[model samples]
Target: MLIGVNYHYIRPWYDEPYPGIHGITPEVFEHQLKLLGRVGHFVGAAEIGEALAGVRPLPDRAFVVTLDDGLREQYEHAWPILRRLGVPAIFFVNTAAIAERRVLGVHKIHLVRAWQPPEKLLERLGQSGRSGNGGQMGALSDVSLIESIRRRAAAHYNYDDPETACLKYLLNFVLEPAVRDRLITECFEEMNPGAESEISQRLYMSGEELRILSDMGCLGSHGDDHLPLGLLTPVEVQREIERSVERIEAWTGRRPEALSYPYGSAEACAPPVSGIATDLGIRFAFTVERAGNPDLRAPLHLARCDCNDLPGGKAACWEADRLFEEIPRREWYLDEHVA
Candidate 1:
């Protein structure tokens, strides 16, 4: 079985501390990569197909690394480390955000920060019927309200068709760094920005950076505005899939055959999306679900382990490696007993 690692958020030492203690610092990331290189076969996405097809030898301790939300940090921080270690990974990006040059769902957080008296923002959220206090508000946080603002801003831009107006409303008003920082602490526990802003001059991977990463053996795709698939209408979901694939293909000049779902889990991997993957001829699809890799039965529903759980960096990498090691034994037991 092939083990996969999902990573996001790498912070610099000097930046304002993240709101919560969830993101991996650059130092920890370096240690993790080194550990993986030392103990396992860090393979590229391409190698997985070869191994699954029985045309190539799978490494004794094979693993793949993947990132979601093609953040500039991947290029600035993660890319250099991956290059030094000679590890191949995949970066799943939401095309709409990239095209708009703004962050998606997280904008609501920025909007809340920008608008004083957090109560007003909460009021807007309540009006939208998407926010409630925990159970009452239905998991809507100050962050969710910010995300709603971003969606509204995007819709306005689409209708107005003016870059300047989009910049004024979406990028300028909601994405200021001070606003982002405040929201991180006040709203959500996690400090990392979920999306980039077109307005702010913050760092993100440039087109050239993307090209270099692709050339260096990193695959790319759509995490689709980071929405849970179960919540969207069928047409909306299709649009998300098509738009993401189209953007990546246009940028990379290679149609991506692999996709990773946002907030993906076994329960979220319904037949509709799986059928979409099959129709698109995608070779692989991934989820955030924690399980052993499927044995060619459903390549589209590959499971992965989130690296965020590993606070020990290199030690954590080893822990992930250990989990992969358990797969075969568990499979053997299941086959022998259950079958």
Candidate 2:
């Protein structure tokens, strides 16, 4: 079976994690990579499109490693490890974040979660961020407070769009855009005062850095702003994909052949999204659908697995992986994140 796996963050083992962001230690990631090396034929994401187009056939254990979001963490923490291993992977980027030079509301939420107490932040947003996850947060335990906030956010974070669910609901839908921006900016100021020009750059890879990765692996579009395309207007969706293709090509010279939906799961692919992608001549599309992609005909809506979910027992894990596409991914993400 051909499988796809992805990651979002990697951090040092002993460092305190920033809240609202999930990370695996470098030790864990390396272990997983080595495990994958032992079992699968590692390939880049763009290659899957070729297999799908019948240009080539995929090997039994063909797979790709993809990193969504052009985070600095990918460049700082994940890049060296990938480089050291001589692994071929894909770094999917959302270009509007660079074009606009502002932090996405979701990232801002993470930053605020790391900077302030959950209690205070919850109170700021008018929700009780406390959770009954059997943990108590004292005023002095910032880590505990962060966990509490995270638990609360997870309770409602249905998908990766990070808006209209938990903190996203309050920040993205409830408050006006300007209001949300001002509030998040104010919260950002509390942590970092007047040092705003490079916030997005600090958080994500620079064009030069991404271009370097392009030579090593491949670059693909996550979206223009990393927002869910299914939730956008047709024009908005087209623009998001088109602009990302343009910007990434501007950086790397070749246009992107693959795109993974911003928060795509199996249920997240809209008809218009596929329609637009076809119009753009995009070759492959990926979703966090947790399965093997053995079929070549259906390339635009391909499935991917989370590497962290792959271990525990190879026999049982392999058996269960096939069911991922059969199961609707929205409910899976909801149950996993909030249930």
lDDT of 2 by residue, 193-284 (tens): 76555788788888888789777547888988766676678898889899999988888887888888876643346656777886887887
The predictions' CA RMSDs to the true structure, in order, are 10.9, 8.1
Taking the candidates one at a time, how many backbone clashes does each contain?
A: 9, 0
Q: Please report the TM-score between candidate 2 and the true structure.
A: 0.75
Candidate 1's error at 174, in angstroms? 23
Model 2 weakest 10-residue run by lDDT: 131-140
- Please give each candidate's TM-score: 0.68, 0.75
Top candidate (TM-score): 2
User: Which candidate ranks first by lDDT, i.e. highest?
Assistant: 2
Candidate 1 accuracy as TM-score: 0.68
| Cα lDDT over the full model 2 | 0.67
C-alpha lDDT of residue 54 in model 1: 80
